[model samples]
Target: MNFKVVPFKALTPQQLYTIYHLRVTVFVVEQTCAYQEVDDLDLTAEHLLGVDTDGRLMAYARLMQEPNQQARIGRVLVNPADRGHGYGQLLVQTAIEQIQQLWPETTQIKIQAQHYLDQFYQSFGFKPVSSVYLEDDIPHQDMILTL
Candidate 1:
């Protein structure tokens, strides 16, 4: 898979459409959660897309720089048909490297991850920083990775 890290303004129309479509398909439809998927945050995010050889988006996430200079990774997802292929790990590892390149001053990365995936993110050095809480009816916890 090829990874591309682009600012919101730099994404092409088709890329932007595909990102939202995939997010809704998995986060909303597949997960059966009914909540707003496209929030105002996307306007300021740097999107990371992992595209396959066929030019289809198989994995994605958004990187955001917080006011305190910490980086946040959010909206992580792998295509339903493409799960169990290790694309998700590659997508996030690429995002971490890209965020460091984009913001060398950043010393910490944060994520609001689903409770069940705590171990997965933990493998990337993220430690739980908050108790599990319900967000949009799904349990999630805040995690941080100090660089």
Candidate 2:
């Protein structure tokens, strides 16, 4: 898989479309969630796209700068057909590395992750910082990784 990390303004039209399409595919259509998928935060966040040699977008995530010189990673997804191939893990690990390069002063990274993936994020050094809660009717918990 090849990874590309760029700001919203820098994303090509096709790249932008692919990102949203994949997010909606996994987060909304595939999961059967009906909430709004195109939130306004995308304009200020850096997007990471994981593409295959065949030019298919297999994974994605967005990193946003938060208050107190911290960063947040969200909208993480791996193509349904690509799951179990380690693309999700690769996507996140690459996001963290890119975040560090983009914001060297950042001291921490946060994620509002699906509850079932708590252990997955935990393996990447993220520790739960909030109790389980419902967001968009899906169980989630806030996790943090201090840099």
Number of the top-ranking candidate, with lDDT as the measure: 1
Please identify model 1 stretches exceeding 4 Å from their true place: none
Worst 10 residues of 1 by lDDT: 85-94
lDDT of 1 by residue, 31-122 (tens): 89999999999999999999989889999999999968799999999999899988888888998999999999999999999999999999
TM-score of each: 0.97, 0.96
Q: Which candidate gets the maximum TM-score versus the true structure?
A: 1
RMSD of each: 0.8, 0.9
What are the per-residue Cα lDDT tens digits for candidate 2 across 53-72?
98799889999999898999
Per-residue error (Å), model 1, residue 136 = 1.1
Q: Model 2 shows how many backbone clashes?
A: 0
- Which residue pairs come into collision in candidate 2? none
